[model samples]
Target chain A: MSPLAALSAAVRLEVVRLATVRSSAVLLALAAAAGAAGAAALCALAERADIGRSGLLEAVTGGSASGLSVVGIAAALAGALVAAGDARHGAERTALVLVPRRGALLTARTVVVAGWSAALAVASLLAAVAVVVLWPQQQLVAASPGPVVLAAPLLGYVGLVVLHGVAGLALTALLRSAVAAVSLVVAWPLVLEPLLGSVLPPSRWGAVLEGLLPAAAASRLVAAPPVAAGTPWLVGSAVAGGALLAAVSALVLLAAVRGARRDA
Target chain B: MIEALALSKRHGSRPALDDVSFTVPDGVLAALVGPAGAGKSTVLRLAVGLDRGSGAVLFDGEPYSRLPRPAHAVGVVLDPRALHPGRTARGHLRSLAAGAGVPRRRVDEVLEQAGVTGARRSRPQHFRRGAALRLAVAGALLGHPRTLLLDDPLTDLDDDSRAWLLDLLRVHADGGGSVLITASRAADVLAVADELVVLRRGRLAARGPASDLVAGLKAGVLVRASDPGLLAGAILRWGGDVEPCDDGALVVTGLDMAAVGEVARAEGVAVHELSRRTADLDAALLSLELPETELLPGANPGAVPGASAVPA
Candidate 1:
């Protein structure tokens, strides 16, 4: 078989293997549930806001954007968990021994992670839209379906989530420990970003720097689009997030190759 | 065919395998006999390209790493525990076949061949040591590899499983597939081995046909007498080594059974038991377990006489 065919087969096998795990099933279920709940809660809170009749109705009908952050975190965790699962069971050695070429195996893993993340992103978005439509203050605006308004943000959000998964997989390979990889993936956004943000000013430059953080990039994608001045910051954050994901993935892949070779 | 040339592997300052080299021709079963930590596993890993080494491992005529699909070229069972705990026996075989681009039907064939078809749906955690080893072997054979590199494949097997495995290996070798197996004990698998490559501290001590190596060891006679000490002394005086056997008997090496019997009869020692004990694979292995320093010409700095020599 051709190399590409072999890689595809390998990735498909990995997906099946990961799907059968109890941990992957639990994590995916939690992420979907959190996304749905967050959407409902955000829509309820938006209906209570006294901004204006039209604004309040519109807000309530659009579902809470806050759920995006939880979904992002959950997606990141899922990615990390999937990548770290192999190391936990010592399956990485088997994979490497069979495949031999470290780069091919890493590529297959990244592809599987990205594919799963995309599916989750779409499912969560649809669930949130359904919840928003069922809100009490729902009104049909010119953008009734919310697809045109949400398409770009959804893509960006999903991209950010996929980046987290890739980064998690890479880190897990480098660390060779699932607990450490998952902790680092979750803590970087929840703990480290806030501390770093406190030290930097809240100006344009500071916002750009913050966007480089994994959490900020994910939030910038899903957060309600800024009215006038914050557009540039959102764009910059998206770009920086993408860059960080690529850079970290590359670095982790290199480390994984070295470790696999050294261990072998 | 498989070849390991000048392979040297060191864990820290201690040498696990120091400049060990050997080759197995196609369609032959070669047994690597060594004690634990004698670099047997290291040699298997290097041959399968699972572990890196300073020397090269060639398959057929090319390096193992350069094979298009290495699984199809060299099947290896390095560790039985390398399988995923969550995957069932069948699932694991299917995954391995998929990764190697082998036909899905091959999975069932292998499972049946390994006699694990009844437990195909069972998870690997539920498998006993023998079952796990069979699964490992089945996985390795999924791609119909030309060469099999197995390390201690008979470690935890019962007599029935060992006999089945021996038959399987013999069949594979007869089908023009080379087999290289390393084992701490040689009693079970040695009968089928065409070549015996003995390793001492990661270096090749001897390489030849198994029969030749066994025959070259000193002849011996199994003798039983009431006064074993006197019989041993008489045997020793005849330039022979006496190995105490169970039931108060002595296996005297370096002397024929008739000569030993004659000596015992002449010395008025009762010859209750008298039989020739040909040096088997076990005896040959014992003779090959020389000091590590002796394998290398200049490994030991101190030139102490007889220190590096092992009594045969």
Candidate 2:
């Protein structure tokens, strides 16, 4: 078979395999639920505190504040879980044994993960829109989703998921164990990212450097407008995060290819 | 034909395969018999390009690395446990079928051939070792590859599965396909192999027809008699090498079973037991162990003695 055909086959198989797992289904369900709930709760809290006489809170929550956190967490989890799956199931070896072309295999997996993450991102966004439209807030000025706002969050989510997925893959490749990779994935944003952010300077350059961090890049997608004074910092942080993730992914992919070639 | 020329591989200053060289001709089943950690798996991996080594693995007339869709030319079942646990047997086969460019119907055909048709829908995680091996074989057969390189395919198989695999490989070789298998259970599998490549400590010990290698070894018949001392002298007088066994018997070398029996009979020695003992692959492997050698960088490791070296 041609390399493209082989890659397509590998991707299809990976998607089917990932979909069959109980963890994947549970994670997706939890993400949808959490995103909806977060959006709703935020909207309610904003309604209760009538200091802001605007529909901005409703728009931020996508109708319900409950879904925002859920969407973020779920998308992040999906990326991490897919990366861990390869090492956990020993499918990485099988994939390498078949293709032996590390680049093609990584490309296929990236496509699959990105496709899944994009689909879920859109679904969460739509759910937020639906919840907002159904809400009984007549005073809230529900602005239609314009091109910039829509594209920003969607692209942002894509970038976040890609960063997480690449990190997950790199960790798994370096560690050669799924549990260890997942543990690092969990610990990085929760512990390391916060610690690093606090120590780093609060300048535009600092934001750029922080953007290289996974958590900072992911936060860029959720930071709503009332434009903060440090907008450049946030944007820099997002770009840095993407660049760091891409660089790390390339390294991990190279290592994985070398390892597979060294031993079966 | 599959050729591994001057192939050498090392792991962190320790050599795993050292200057190993051998050729498996088309239409013949060859067995690489060696002890554990003798680089058997490494050889298989390098042959299929799953592992990088300082040497060359050529399929038919060209290097395997240059082949387009290598699976069509070389079918490999390196690790039986490498299958994804989440996939069912059928799903696994179908996925490989799609990749190998085989018809979907061949999936069922291979399943039936492998005796895994009944478990087609069962998840691979639920399979026993034999079932897993059968599935692996089915995957290797998907594209009807001309060469099958199996590493310890019979490691955890039952008698029936082993026999079935042997017969299957025999048929594959008979149909003009080359089969190179690595196994420690040489006596069982080597019986069907046309040639035996004996390896010891990452070096080729012996490479020739199975019968020739077995017969060439210092082997003979074990003759049991009431008076072992007399039989030993008689065999020695007849220009045969004989040694006394623990149980009042003489292990004679350089003579066939019939010759030993006839000599004992003529010497008025009553023989209780007389059995032919040939040197097995394991014994041959042990007899020819070599000291480890550091692999030179960018050298053709598998180049046979005096063979022209290919630039690494």
Candidate 3:
């Protein structure tokens, strides 16, 4: 078979394997719950406290658009399990045997897992939309987003989710342990990246580092809520964050090639 | 054909395999036999490029990694237990089948061929060891590769399953495929191999036709008499090592039937039964160019091949 055909088959197999696992079902349920809770909280706050349009968007979008909270964490977990599951279950031995070329095998896994994570983000977005239409949060907002205006952040949220997941998968491959990979991903925006973002001066160094943070990019895509509407660095952080996501993807592909040669 | 040349594998500071070289010719099945730690499994792993090792393993004279579709050239079953527990037998084969660009229907075909029936929809964890082995073997056959690298494929097989698998392997070989199996039991697998590669202490002990290795294996005759003790004593005095059996017969090692009869005739001892007994697989291996006296005595405990029953 040609390399392209082999790669296509591998991706198909990986996608099916990930979808059939019991954990995927549980993950979907958890994502749904997170989306529902985020929407409900946003709707309640919009009606009671009068937060406005961006607040309503953030509420319905959940922290997913910002690359923080449930959606991003769920996406990261999904990515980590794609790799960590194989190692933990000893399926790596079988997988390597089947594909033989470690680089191809890793590449297939990255594409499939990242694709699934992005799809999950879309699902969460759809759930958020249902809540917006059902709960009537328009009265609290002065102005709502047009379809064109809304599409940018929706696409951005999907990109952020993919980045979070791909990063998780790559880190899992690097560490060869799911727990370590997931911990690093989970703790990043929750503690480390945000802490660093806050402590560092709002200068070039901070801008560079913030761009590297997926959650910051995702947060910028959501444009933060009315809670912190006056934050001045939104556009800079979003641009940097998106570029950082692309950079990490290249790094993952390179690492996969280098790692397979050494370890396979 | 599967050819592994001067392959060397190391784990930490210890060498798992050293200059291991052999070939499973096309249209033939070969067995790698040794006690535990003999590196039988290592050879299969290195052959399929599952483990990093020095040297080259070629499938049909091309490196497994170089094959456009390695699965089509080589199908490997490294560990039966290594199968994903949550995946049904069909699910497991489906994923691998896709990677090989095989039609989805081929999964059902392999499951049928491997003797895995209705259990295809159930998780492998619920299957018996034999069932799981068949599922694993079915997965290996998914690509219809010309070469199969199996790691202890008969580990948990029963007598009927063993015969069935032997037939399947023979058919694979007959159809012009190469079968390279890592095995510990000499009796079961030795009978199936087109050739035998004996490993001892992670080194090549011997490699030749199975028929040639079994040549020096027959050690003595089993004789049942009216007075087995008396006959045993006479045989012992005549330089034969005798072990009394539960059936009141003597298993005479080191003496042929003609000599045994002569001794019986001289002693006026009447023999009820006389038959020759060939050495078993382990004895055949040990006595290959070695003295016949080292037959491991009576009843080699823990004698199962491919198991970790190494001599201390």
Best by DockQ: 3
DockQ of each: 0.39, 0.34, 0.49
| iRMSD value for model 1 | 2.7
Q: After superposition on all CA atoms, how large is the RMSD of candidate 3?
A: 5.7
Candidate 2 residue A98 Cα shift, in angstroms, is: 2.2
State each model's CA lDDT, in order.
Answer: 0.70, 0.67, 0.74
* Total backbone collisions for each predicted model: 0, 28, 6
- Model 3, A1-264: lDDT tens per residue? 356765776787787687656788787777777777887777777676766556656765684544576777788788888878787766777777666666667789888878888777777777876776687534533455555555556666677777778887888887887788779887876788778778877889877676666556556765533333333544564575656577668759766866766644
Q: List model 3 lDDT by residue over B36-100, tens digit each.
A: 78889888877777778899988888887778877777878777776666677787888778767
- Assess chain B of each prediction and give its TM-score: 0.83, 0.80, 0.80
Cα-based lDDT at residue B131, candidate 3:
81
Error of 2 at A35 (Å): 2.9
C-alpha TM-score for every candidate: 0.84, 0.80, 0.83
Flag regions of model 3 displaced more than 4 Å.
Answer: A136-142, A194-214, A224-238, A250-258, A261-264, B221-252, B256-278, B283-312
Tens-place lDDT per residue, model 2, B131-164, is 8999999988887789998989888788888888
Q: On residues A114-200, what C-alpha lDDT tens digit does candidate 2 reach at each position?
A: 676666655655665566556677334344334454445545554554455555555656666656665666676678778988999
